[model samples]
Target: MSDQHVYLEEVFSSIQGEGIFVGVRQVFVRFYGCNLRCSYCDTSETRAGNPVICRVWRGCEPGRFSETLENPLGVDIVADLIRDLWSPSTRHVSLTGGEPLLQSRFIRRLGERVEMPFYLETNSTLPGAAVDVAGVIDVAACDIKLEESGVEDDHGVLFKRSLETIEIFNDSDCLVFAKIMILPKTTVATIMPAVTSIAEINPEIPLVLQPVTPHRSNPERLIEMMDAAGRYLRDVRVIPQTQRVLGVL
Candidate 1:
């Protein structure tokens, strides 16, 4: 394994809150840094340099108990922690980030050493890095960011790149799915490109419409969004952030 260390925000076991793998137990490895600035992003703290402290679960107890360690933690140390947290029902170690592909090299090294399956949660804007690490991942939980979301980059440029990344996953045997966040003002016009992109690539890939948490979610609007998606895609569903509803981390 490479000796390169990784800057982490946190590493702990939790049930996945959204998308296809909702409620599946996972050990989340949250890295720092992202390329975009979405308007409703809640994980604002994961936006910068290596954290001075990393939070990790200390024991196998059912109740939450965590301990802190210095940042830029070693790969071997993280691998050991993964082993410590392993269990029969544990699905995979999810590599989530402000954008995990930003640190693709570190992820490649860690994935090589860890025995558990690697689940990648990415923004789908880094096609090059997505291709670099896609073969090793067991699942590609990608996002189709909308223009109205207030991203930092040019909307078309980022959207094209995300589509390219999705196209890569579309051809792979590895599971691929899209997570599109629906805002109050979100309409069929805002969702067509994302829907058409997946349809043009491979229509079988699941499309998940996740509503922004703490917003006034109109059921009728969600159905309309799903109807918009069904025009181009086959399997479309509306799933909210269940972890927030269940009051879990």
Candidate 2:
């Protein structure tokens, strides 16, 4: 293993208001940096330097949490933080990011030492990187981006690889959930191919269709995509970002 430490943005405890684990209390380790620039990202602040303080919106008053240490913590130190944040109410520890696959080795090391189940939230653009640390994660929440989001690189190949990565995890003991962000520009005609691909793999796997928030360039597209997705996907459900509704961080 490399002796070098990996960069980490911040670590904090919060409720999991998205995906299958929605409403569950979780300790979130948000890693800094990302490979892709999704147009509708809400956590743009986390894309830079190691996060030292988190501005949390609580009621009318905003609260702040500070981290004395620097970014990119070593495995041992990260382990201790996970333990400190672990509570009877905590269901899982989420390794989120600008993109978690960017620091797969570091996250794998942290998962190896921690006792609680580890969950990962990824954009599903880096399948090979994700597979490298698949053993360390218990669950993966992957997002499939569409043209409306401005991610116009070879999405066909990226989405295919994402499914391959999901299949890899599905063959294992890990729980995998495929998520597609429904944008105003995303229509059934645009996303049907991707949805069909996922259904072909394992229809039993939970597929989450999340509506793009009002902040996006297109809000009406969300409703259209939801209706379109519902026609082909039996397990599809439309959910907005609950954190936004709750007005929390």
Candidate 3:
């Protein structure tokens, strides 16, 4: 297992920018690669092939950066970096990605070795992979992509898996929540089904309406979608990319 490692983009500490866990301090272990490329996506690094090396900061402080670590970094090494950067305020070890679920075994193994709680930030399109790690994850921050999300996915298949992923968390003690990227073209027709689908599965799970970008925010549209979602789901909120606003990594 010393040679076995997961490809990663970066590992750093920052606040939880979206979902019900927003504002909580977290150490983000961002994995490399993703299945879907949403047009409005801000995770630009995820679009490329796996990096030959994984970058980490020398310290947990926001701006400090460390020498790159080789790709497919051993679980022990990844575990050390996470432990090194963890701070007193750190809430959980956030397994974010290109799609963290893509590397289910790594997450499962890492969760076993780490002392911190594991919080998974994922695109709920991959239910099978979600199941692979669901048993180990402490909090499931699942993103349900809508048509307005501009990802290359079969809507029926996408929604079905999204439901399955949510249900995976529902059947467990993991805190589950959904975040839908509400674009400018996003309309009630496009939004209702997602909220309705989530409502049908578990209305108690919070839904976060995040505009494509925080700089050119469309508050009216965000509010409208929030209002529309509020009808079916009890806990729906409009949260912008506060990380982008506060200028934190």
Q: Global lDDT for candidate 1?
A: 0.85
Each candidate's TM vs. the true structure?
0.94, 0.86, 0.93
- lDDT (CA) per prediction: 0.85, 0.74, 0.82
Instruction: Please tell me which predicted candidate would have the highest lDDT against the true structure.
Output: 1
lDDT of 2 by residue, 4-41 (tens): 46666567777887887888888888777887778888
RMSD of each: 2.2, 3.4, 2.1
lDDT of 3 by residue, 123-159 (tens): 8888887887877888998888887677787877888
lDDT of 2 at 146: 71
- Deviation from native of the Cα of residue 193 in model 3, angstroms: 0.4
What TM-score number comes out for model 3?
Answer: 0.93
Of 1 and 2, the candidate ahead on TM-score is 1
Question: Model 2: residues >4 Å from true position, as ranges?
Answer: 1-4, 48-63, 215-233
- Judging by lDDT, tell me the better candidate of 1 and 3: 1
Model 3 weakest lDDT span, ten residues long: 57-66
Q: Cα deviation of 13 in candidate 3 (Å)?
A: 1.4
Q: What value does the lDDT take at residue 74 in candidate 1?
A: 87
